[model samples]
Target chain A: MNLTILIVMAVLTGVLGSPYVTDTDVTPGSDSAGMSAHPNSVPEAADGTEVFHEEGVVEEEGVEEDVMATGELNPSHYPAQRAANVVKHYLNTRYGSPYRWVGLHKVHSANAEEVAESGRKYHLEISVQEMTGNTTEKCSAEVLFPALENQRSPQVQASCEALLTANTTAQEEALYQQYRRNHTLLSGHNLPDSYGHIDPDMKPLWHLGGVASSFVMLKESTENTLYNMAQVANVTQLETENDQLRFNYHVLLHDMVSQEIIHWKLLVTWSPAEGVKVLQMEELPKCEHCEVPPKPN
Target chain B: MKALLILIVLMNLDKNKCFAFLSFSDQVLSITAKTQEQVELLKNVSTQYETVLWQPVSPEYIKEEEPVHLSPSAFAQSFASRFCFRVLLDNTNEMIELQTRNDSTDPRSSSSYYERYHSLEDIYYWINRTTQEHPEMVKVVLIGSSYEKRPLYALKISVGEKQDKKAIWIDCGIHAREWISPAFCMWFSLSYYNQNQDITHILNHMDVYVLPVMNPDGYKYTWTTNRMWRKNRSYSTDSSCVGVDLNRNFDANWCTEGASDKPCSEIYCGAFPESEPESEAVANFLRSHKDSVQLYLTIHSYSQMLLFPYSCTLDEAENHNELLVMAQEAAQKIRRYYRNTYKYGAGGKTIYLAPGGSDDWAYNLGIKYSFTFELQDRGRYGFLLPPSHISKACNEALIAVKTIALRVIEKTQAPQ
Candidate 1:
């Protein structure tokens, strides 16, 4: 932790000069001469949130030049957008893998504030997309841009565990054991068998496909793309390497915006304790009769 | 008409005490904090004009360009400058008025009847009146009473004499502030006879149990005290904070991530699973009917998603594929018909990993086909889905309900 910390408080509209805004503010404070406060105020802990009063570095009163905030920010605007952009980098740094590309799908909310000594800090609640897995999470994070003198990767504080998991090795192990016991190298032509239905036994592979593809998606995605795992075109389980089970998968990526079904082949490895790791990705030549969604998002 | 007048007077008498004296934020605005200069400018405005943030819950959460909705004091409007403020609500007081509005209308006008958001008193009246009108199909089953002693009414919808048949259990308004959820339940019941083929077909093979307003105490609190109130109105004797998140009071991985153990936390799991009477009532009902109930569905709002079991863990449900397809079909049906997109997947994988969810609990209880549907307006309107959008939202939900229920029937009742 740095000795001098920065605090960016968004939505402190009436308490700009004040060091803090508490529940007491909801009542028309005596300081407010004419304005009336909200009478039907939310009781403490009633609104699915804990008051953002953290036990962090609290500075002295009267740092007049220290704070900056506007309650909400435009998603398209630079400050908020850049904050969202940093989260993409943060996820890649934390959960990045081969064959997976991650990016910000949408910004639910973004706001920025500049504090003294350090730099500007942004509090953002955003949805992150793991492109290959076709999975998304609405994650709330804090990103701080340091002062010019203390330049570094934008300091990020986000708990995006949905895209990354380390504790589920038990489930992975059990599945791996079951797969190994089958003796023959598992291989399948299509995940859903073309009936838009995955066989009971084949469901786990489909899920792992999504998980492995997330790495590629995370690597290649951006603010503009909305990707979906259209199918596991074909997958063949390779011989076990040490402890991990390796598989070669060809999957279809449907770009919802362009309504194009793109094909790619992935070299993925999985083990119960360790997790799905994409070894490589290769984009195959486009097929002429690739099906298109009637209405793509 | 005379009875309706008395109900109105009673609702007013109830509201005029403590609640009527409440003051509300006149206008709510979604504003942008684009730069340091803009943040300073907003700080100056708040210090000068006194606007309060409606979203983000507190000022500490504000960041550059993080979408924060501000309930700027009417006083701030004249002097507010520099920030590009997008108006979200002119006056939340007006919205609150409609939510608690009690008006007499001809039941024949289905539009007027189903469109308005009803008060606790209004919903009870509707349940009684509807049961009387449709004596053959609808029967009110009192599952249990809330902490405040309000009877939890579950409407059992069947076509004829109830015989041993498969059942589907759906409980709504579990979180209280989710008024749209209870509204969907009412809409679902009414449409059972709306010349709706899907509802009729499901009722042929399965009896539907619809519990509207599961958390009556919390639901009533939102009307009388806090509009954004979630959780039930129950209190732990040791803690000052009132209420347990009923959704998180189930037995499946109780008090895990996305849930809190502290009594004051919003998603606080009760002292133990099934601790809250609301969750206990629903759990007991499902347990007793575990053999016959083929499916379970719970309703919530704001984010449009069809979620199935295993919200407690990252691991896939034993029937993950089956549940996912059912939810997918439901979402696709809504999209194809109403043109609204809905994300569908495992509750843990699709959204956040919220433990102690009813859907997961029900699935663990052997009800393989379980779901939680979050309905309407991704984040734009959120829980305060307006009355104008009520019909469309309800119809979209109805499509999903029918699609899933029909699918369950096919899978369970197919010629063996």
Candidate 2:
């Protein structure tokens, strides 16, 4: 190496190992799609203090585990839908997201196994969709329902690969607190407005509504149905409860597969700590031609 | 003389000093610049500590109230409290170490050298040798030469002797430090030449145009001198920075917010668009073949993302939804096969608003399916991704490439 290159490398090495200075094309943008053009930018949250190194060689799982083949069970049944419901909660806790908020779109097949005195395990093949964006992915998840159901949360291992969640906890937390502090929590109707545009600040509210609606869609969802939160017919802010903000929403759910617009009402509460919780959901009477969004209050 | 003595001192410093030191706390910290003085102070601190910044890459990127993030892995607290800095993360060294711990590569390994990281010379040799070996399948075309007068070689790979097939154009290693990008191109070429039937099926549909190393001069510089050079070996009358960020040298929304115009800056966009020979060559080649090339894929590394236009602005692409779904499907394939996560969406929304990028330029030129892939190990090993990951990273990228190529074919070349 030339003296200049060696000296530059040496100074950088001493400064912060090879992970130093401007020059090397390194992307420590653990969360953001940070522009690489900027030198000296490391990841935001990945502190320099210490990290646990999982020392496994880059080797593929050579043997593919074949799931025992079984007949496809009806997705609308209580047992099947209950297990799928567990998957939805599991996903929310892992994500608790706004953009890449994924919910169970459909349960294609379900196989139930009863464990003596332990629990009932459900092996499921399902589809998960990004609630905000209209992309759905096929996922294989295994959910275990312990015999003592109320006492323990179901353990779930899901292969829901196509999820695009942003690491904006700081922003989300700030937004949540900002909303809580306000006497008027963002309540609106026909968001994306008449012009098909949602103000950037109001996007999180709609995203939350979509996430809350996921619970209803997940419950009513079957192998034949595809659902999306089309529009917020009306949304109203309710009182806060124990640091969680509650809201009442009248929303339209569009079934893409069937091209039908349905109306539903939901009671929801959310906090950064408690994620999104759907307290209640009630389907409204069939309203024909409800695609014409209700006028904003 | 001072530089030489400084070099000597740096050379003598114990490598284990990083481990032995207890006073230092490696942390990702933020410094909010209330004034230009504070911004200048931050720039100085960044230089002194060699901190890797996290957000608002440059002080210029810092908005009115937005704070910038930096990983001062070598800085301790109680120093420079004037800036109101907060610790974002600690233990980045251990993380990076853990990430690279599995990096095992031996040049002496398997005689089949196609699966290894090669020098610029070796890459050139491979291009020649492969062209000779697979005369029927591969034909080497000299796109243009680098600023250092190195020939930029592109291979047109097609199964049968069909000159006018709808094609897929791929260019790799545009940024020299991103070694994995070039490695992908090499792996892709080797796989096709190896009679990988699945790859051949795609070739049967679209003639594959592969530029193995887009910036040869900078790549050679990385191998020989500094391993972090991200630009071409070009010169300008104004400054002595010695190179221009070729990716930023494209004409689309040239040198906007995400890019820097100062020649010394890494993202300096060149005197104008196509100021450097490397970028000029690529632009010319893509422009001439814009009609035939249905998909233009540019490979990059470290941030495992499948990005499409337009990175230049916050505005969505005309076919943004189509591109998003394609990228999503490609990402899913990587996840299912490799068990790794890859973010897929519009470049602007998915990553950040990066102007003058090649993908955006290519897309604007009417290559509807243009994409730029940032490959492998999210941030663990970054640019220095190690030889052991060569096969896995390349394979992961290959999966994404094939998925998108098949999708384009299904959309475009359907039988009547």
Candidate 3:
């Protein structure tokens, strides 16, 4: 009876002891699996700069708790997890936006094992929902995480930096503030209202052009302020010469009372001699992908 | 029961078959063809992939980089790359879908003019209701019937002493896809009834005749069958093709230049001058009331232009200077009020030489202030101006029309 029991125990152990076993404990210094086993694994930093690492075995019960604690899986834990984490981090840091996580897909490759062994590409597709003004925008981004630890952070940093530099809303707001200051200064000085009579000192930044057709200057006594809520959506530099710079900016204008929004492309040519001249302003056609955000109840 | 089931299945099959030819994936490209070769290439590619040209007369009008809208399939990508173009609208289907979504607004309950595009039936109902509600000022006159026997109605709006007053004849939707044209007419009529201060003098001095939809069948077809159909639904001698461009079927310069004889062409002038019953009926009515009709205004869209007679030729009209001065003044007034620019000149020089225009015909018939307004946009949305823009478009046109009408009244009142 003892011999028979020993044989049965050996058979059971054999069945559950393989590498493909479902409940195998993650061993230390094993590069194949586990978050803490990676060569570049570092402890969690207070500034959220270091790559993520999870302690203990990746048990079935712990997965949900781990996900909740970390917001997402640690990049070093799984080959696909790195890409998704990088993309999420990139969007979160870049826009500082509240977004709905739509989907994350791990792209399969025939040479995935080899690629992971080389510590190179980890391809993933991620989708998120964002709101621009009143419109909800669904954006899909494909991320390919680089293997080098030093390069990874810089890649994300570079992308965020590029987006920050090209932030048109901030630029337009600055320009508008400058315009208002100039307007106040000119009005205070009591300049003439006719063409060619603008103050020479203020000619570099602001000049009098025809008011856009879609905008109406309301009477001050009406208490209905015609606020120029305009944002530069896009800018294209058409020509650059020694003295003059010609550029076109697509601006989105929104009215407070009417709740009317219109997109217009304005061509502007600037030079020291000519000051700033609005060459043309035309309304852009409606876009299918764009939607006005719903009013909050 | 089996027969009914078979009929239902067959109907589904028929619907699927119709959609097989109509691709929802087709894209609308705005090509600025500068050379004859590029224009010819466009025509060639159009043959392979189904295309609908939107602006300018034809391929011949591509000399100065004129904008042309072409709906081409993905297969034409290689052909499209050879030319310089902008994707004005990506998907034609999506555009139509967007324009037609929940567009039904009952004109009765809506105190303000229904800004969204309305169906033909809704427009007709609005017309009938307006006349019925204001029997004193509004009178519905059945001008004629379309080829499909749709009654052509015109509203004669006059508040008081209609006998001796001069009249301003305003017609819209001469080309069916120009939906804003008809919308302007409806808005103008409603605003006049409400005694809009700008047009109050014009209404008090003269009667206004508004034929809101000239080509009813074509307008209905645009809503139902094809969104881009531009002519009246009149069967030609050839049984395969249909429609006659009513603007080109008028008597002035009849089929001379910038018009076609082919039945399949968009600008096909009919078999003879005033061939389409719609045009013939309008011409007959104008002829009968030539003495009282001092000014004729026909509204079309996409180009902000106010053009006067002689669209058939380069030659100036006898009252060219007077018409030019009046149009300039009207444009200036519109600019000052709305800050929108409107180009004004003789039709042939300002726009294209489209021969048989109603304005030209009216000018020939002795209506000195005959003008055509290409309203609102400058070819950005082309024929599809959204409902939100209706107020602006109508307001600007209102200011210009009031200016012209006041000028016409002044010109007529001055002693010879």
Q: Which numbered prediction scores highest in lDDT against the true structure?
A: 2
lDDT winner between 2 and 3, please give it.
2
Displacement of residue B399 (Cα, Å) in model 2 is: 0.6
Please give me the DockQ of candidate 2 compared with the native complex.
0.01
TM-score order, best first, reads 1, 2, 3
Worst-scoring 10-residue span by lDDT in model 2 chain A: A49-58
- Per residue, candidate 3 scores C-alpha lDDT tens digits across B1-416 of 22223223322321111111211122334566667777788766655554444444344554446556554543454665566554332222222222223434543222134455667898999899889989999999999998899999999998776577789999999888788889889877866754532356677788999999999999987676544457888887664568888988988888886788877666788999998889989999999999999999999975577889878887889988888788888776655434456667787654446788899999899898899998966422345454545655776687688788888888787532
Question: How much is A33 displaced in model 2, in angstroms?
Answer: 40
- If the candidates were sorted by their DockQ against the true structure, best first, what order would they fall in? 2, 1, 3
Please provide, for model 2 over A52-128, each residue's C-alpha lDDT reduced to its tens digit, 9 standing for 90 to 100: 11111121211211122124444433345456756765675456545445555555667877667767678887766
lDDT of model 2, residue B222 = 68
- lDDT for position B201 in model 1: 65
Q: Which tens-of-lDDT digit does each residue in B1-416 have in candidate 2?
A: 33345334433432211111212223344456778777776766665654555565454565434566665533433344565554333223323322222234443443124445778887888789888988988899999999999999999988886668899999999988788888889878866753332465688889999999999998987676545567888888987667888988999999887777887666778899988888989999998998899999999875567888988986878998888789888876665545555656666654455788899999999999999998865322345554545655676688788889889998998773
lDDT (10s digit) by residue, model 3, range A126-179? 332221111122233344333454343313221222232223355344543453
lDDT of 1 by residue, A170-219 (tens): 55567778887778899875554321234557767766675666555545
lDDT of each: 0.63, 0.64, 0.54
Write down the C-alpha DockQ for each prediction.
0.01, 0.01, 0.01
Off by over 4 Å in 1: A1-297, B1-111
